[model samples]
Target: MPLRLPPLPALRFFEAAGRHQSFKLAAAELNVTPSAISHGIVGLEQALGVELFAREPRGISLTASGADYLSYVSEAFSLIAIGTQRLPNHRADRPIALSCAPTFASRWLLPRLAGFRARWPNVNVSVDTSHRQVGFPVDGFDFAVRMSRAPVAGTAWTRLFGERFVPVCSPAYLANLRDEQGNADLRRATLIHVNAASEDWQAWFDATGTEGIDTAAGLRVDTIQLAFEAAAMGLGVALGRRPLVDRDIDNGTLVQACAATIASTTAYWLVSAENADRRPELFDFKRWLVSEAEHFDTHANPADQALQSTAN
Candidate 1:
């Protein structure tokens, strides 16, 4: 049979008091009165028939037995804290869940997620990468990052990155491309198509203001990263967001086809409940994202803090 133990409340109070060497500080952390903490510790000492603390003029100090007991208590409390931290990650409410388009999630968000974690270590990020529209109130998600041309009604939205489309292809594809007009020479190349986003091609066609080109006839993909990968593999041309494709463009893996890139009305937007507008975690994420976006616009590598300095 296992040995029965004293009440948990008494043991907890004693442990906190011993660790802090102050009932007042322990009461603050436990959200209890100082007197109550003192009483619980006194009750514990009475039960054990040992002097745990050496009462002093400035503050309390641990007795020989108390010092030994504190080592065990500290380890136990550390284990409890570790377990408690995991509970929030599993909890359904306020889950810090985010919804994003498949292409953006795979190509843009996932690649940069480590930076987000580095900034906010406590936040538990759950990503829902889908092309489908997510209604947050009906879906019970804490937040959603949507890529759209227009903001949805009845939702709080913050524009994450302005839309700027550039035609990008792998270095081999660019080398093989026969264009006397440099960047504007993409009219001869085969255009990659995103099946879900017919508008991207339509916008390109609109910007070119040319006719007799079929935008529908190419290797069709559903995700942005897939299209990008196809382009990177020297298969064909793909229109890419500046924020998502900037790194590839800079590193010589991809090259811009022209300076005719247009800033589209479409943009990456963060959507959430109005009540969560000022949430600290959400706010921190938003600020970081905006900072990165701005940095990328002015400079190439936003992650390299030194890049901006060299450019200036």
Candidate 2:
């Protein structure tokens, strides 16, 4: 008996669409047109006799069935990828596949990636950024860097460093917040929030024993990068997560909004499968990563040092 299954292309479309919930993004990732992605998924729905997505004016969302189907489909693809990677003829020089958090990837890792390339000229790194905690070899990633409060229960995991959250904004904006005594007055300031629902502002407030300022009133953005950008434009104060915000603060794109600093509950970690020993490149990459983190300088900017000194 022949097994019933959607076309390979259709399945690929469905998987990508389900993961991103955006036909345009899925199409871009697959190097195809958005219409092609939409049509392929439509053909897939017709084959399966089930609606996989609810199309909305702003965007699309996976249906309950689609969500369930996505799990199995994703797992099947992961297995296939793992098998392909294990093939004897697999190239020795395949790029390192790394899964990392989106914000960290864009703000911290991408900036330092050049340094890594400089050290290991022959080695290549392919980064896939997501907030998802993807599995080890099953997900076809050689390794991953994730943010967490505790170590992963069972994996080759190591702590990188903790982050300090400080409010930051453009220097011109900071000048306005300075009071007669040179201390910041946040009561009249606008807050730039990463997410409306997140406790970023509230946590900072609690840590600093701050009150009287309205944390609920703020410009909300989906990503930390956007938050920093908004703050840089003198729009409002952003809860700047250090390491991620270091470069911006260093370059004078942003300034310390206030002297108060709060340590983050979560820190970045490097996680890999125990069997990663099979890849010598993984070892070298990990060593390079550890060294980079160990020596990361957060206080190099002269202007920034002067500002912090005054604020203190």
CA lDDT of each prediction against the hidden true structure: 0.70, 0.81
- Candidate 1 off by > 4 Å: 1-94, 179-187, 277-312
TM-score of 2: 0.74
Q: How do the residues 175-236 of candidate 1 rate in per-residue lDDT, one tens digit apiece?
A: 66755645345656789988776358778668757577787677788877788888889889
Give TM per candidate. 0.59, 0.74
lDDT of 1 at 81: 45
Each prediction's RMSD over C-alphas, in Å, is 20.7, 4.9
